[model samples]
Structure formats: C-alpha cells, structure tokens
Target: MDDRRELPRKLAHEHLARGDATGWFEALYAEADGKEQVVPWADMQINPHFAAWLAAHPRPEAAKRALVIGCGLGDDAEALAAVGFQVVAFDVSPTAVAWCRDRFPASTVQYAVADLLKLPEDWIGRFELVLEIYTVQVLPVELRRQAFERMAQAVAADGTLLVIARGRDATDEPCNMPWPLLHDELKFIETCGLREVSFEDFLDQECPPVRRFRAEYRRPATITSAKS
Candidate 1:
C-alpha cells in the first residue's frame, strides 16, 4: 500500500481504537484538505455503477428526492443533482460537509453533517432514492447493522436503495480500515423490508482487481409485496 494512503488509515485505526467511532472521518477529511493524497477512497469521480444504473433506469418523474450517505467531496451527490434529483447528501464530519459546500458553492445538493445511526426524524421514509457507496464497510462491524437499518428507513415506500461495497468471502477475517462485506452481510440488507432487485459481484478494473458487490434493493409499494 502507498505510504501516503496509509496515513489516513492509521489515523482511522488510532481513533477507532480509542472508542471514537466517527471522529476519524473528520480527521481524515481535515488531513485530506491539507494533503489530498491521503484520501485513498477519493477517486474524484462519480461511481460508474451509479451512473450506469441511473442511465438504464431513469425515474418517471424528474423531481425525485435522493439521499447520499457519506457524501464525501460531493461527487456522487453532484452527479445525482445533475440528473435532476433534489439531493440531500450528508457526512458525519462537519468539516467534510463544509468542504463539500465550499467545493460547490452554487450546487443544488444540500450537504449536511448527519450521523447514519441517529438520522433525523423528518428524513425517515422521505427519499425516493438512497445511495450508499462504501460507507458501511468503513464502519466497525457492530455498527454496520444499525447503519443498514437507517439507510433502509430513509427510503420511501417505492424508493430504491443502491449499495456498492468491497466484497469478501464469508470466512475472511475482518481486516483494518475498510472491513470488506461478506456475501451474507450484503444479503442481510433485504431483512430491512426491502426486496433485492438486482445483485452482482464483479472485479473492479483496477490492477490486482478489487472484488465488489453492486446491488439494488427496493421497498415495495405494499406490505404484502414487500413480504413476498
């Protein structure tokens, strides 16, 4: 791994070890502002899977609402806004939200500081689309289930949840920083009253290809359908 990349990872591990479950996010963003090279996950581009999904599955209405979890640097949030969704993108770090707004002064994306585990009441069941990319994997395993529940709760009755995360086999031991999601863990998202619409496992195009899971789950229009 690149030494520069390891800086934020080390900071994350240090903070998480000290029982600060979310402080490392702020520290990482603050450090990245000073030295952009430290943000290993900052691709500076919208996720291609999201883009392709949006292209192939356009919403009937142009004014849908979208929620982007852990909206780092606002790239994906901005992309959603560009496609005409009223977007609310949030991160746990105040610094990250401020940086995102500053980066896009006239942007339509409403960037805010919000915790996934303790989401705002008004946000529950309000979004037509919820996008989560690599956020839960960075969290401690104990917090992942709550994070998933919050993500699911934000979706409207007919809304869709898009999740993209690093994938690992079920038997793989938990690793540092981003603890890759096991296949069963990914499937667990369905337990939150959503139906799995599509699921795919593929190798990312990067050298020494990274395994990834790209999935879509939808909250059915009715309780009966959702249960089925």
Candidate 2:
C-alpha cells in the first residue's frame, strides 16, 4: 500500500494516543507540504455544491461577511472573496494558515489560525455566512457535537450556515478518520436555534459513489419591540 494511503490513519493513531484529538490535522498538512503531493481532501478547486448554491442565492453587497471553517489551501476562501464576500477563512493549523496566505499573496480573504473548539469571543455571532465543509467529520467522534455547536454559534442572527460532508445512515458502524456523519447528527444543527432551509443527500459521481449531504440553515430575524 502507498504510504500516502496510510498517512492519515498513522497520524490519527499517533496523535490520539497522546490525547491530542485535533493535532493530526497540522501534522498531516506538514507532511503533505514536504511530499509535494495533493492533500487527500485538496481538490484544488472550490466545492461545486458551494458554487452552485451561491449562484442561486446571491448575497447582497451589504451582507458580505463570510466565515470559512477549516479553510484548507485557500481555494474556497478565494472563491468566496471572488464573489464579493469579506471572507475570514481559518484553520486550526498554523502551518495550513501560513500556507494559504503564502499561496494567495494577492488574496483578499483573511486567513488565520483558529481552533474551532476555542474560538475568539468577538467572533461569536459575527459572520453573515458560515461555510463548513468536511471539518466536523474529520474531528474525533467525541468532539463532533461541541464542534457543531461552535460552528453554529459563528453565524450572525439572520445569517446563513451551509455544511457539506460525507454522510452515512444510522445503522453503519462508526469508522475512523474522516468519519462519516449520520443523518441525525446533521439534523442536530436545528438544536442551535437555526431553521433548516434545505437538506439533500446524494451520491457523488466517483468510481464508488460517495454518500454525502448538503444542508443549509438560517438564523431567524430577531424581533425587537418598539420603545415608546
């Protein structure tokens, strides 16, 4: 088997053994940088689903704030910026953040190192749109719930949250790295006070069709009472 095939598993075991659930992300990106190969999840393009969604529902110029969680390699971030968003794209790995900045020297997206679990206080409810793709599924199963909550917390009231990830049915046994999210798990976003605008599950056109879900949720507008 190619070392690249085993790289994620090996990194997961090493980091999880040391009680570092999220450290494998940084380690894997560093290794990929050294090897000069495409990272497993790096398609070198923005997610097609995200692009399609943007086309159908163009955001207003005044509602330009966007947040990209686990922004790898800056492709998605750049895509958001190209569409007129004031984007803040962040990854837990400093190496990944630095790589994105260096890769897109002329980019308008602000790339930074930010842990999803311990986000900055000021960032809470700060973005008009939050894009979360494949980030939660990569976390240890134990951390998925909290990660989901934090991601939801970033969306400003009346904003939108879009999530795309590998999906599995309730009966499938839990697997390792890139753990597929269950349907119920994805539905948990409603628990964070956002209303589901849409949810779709489909198979991608890969050799072996990959099961995935694309979900959009929106924060309801807050009603303020008139002061006499």
> Best-fitting candidate, measured by lDDT?
1
Superposition TM-score, candidate 2 onto the true structure: 0.94
lDDT for every model?
0.87, 0.86
- Clash pairs, model 1 backbone: none
Q: Give each model a TM-score.
A: 0.93, 0.94
| Candidate 1 deviant stretches above 4 angstroms | 223-228
lDDT of 1 at 147: 93
lDDT of 1 by residue, 37-72 (tens): 677777778988777787888654758999999998
> Model 1's lDDT to the true fold?
0.87
Per residue, candidate 2 scores C-alpha lDDT tens digits across 1-228 of: 235547878888999999998898899888787343636777778888788888888656674789999998888889889888999999998888888888889999999899999988888999999999999988877888898899889999899999999999878877767788887987788999899999989998777888989999999977899899
Give the best candidate by TM-score.
2
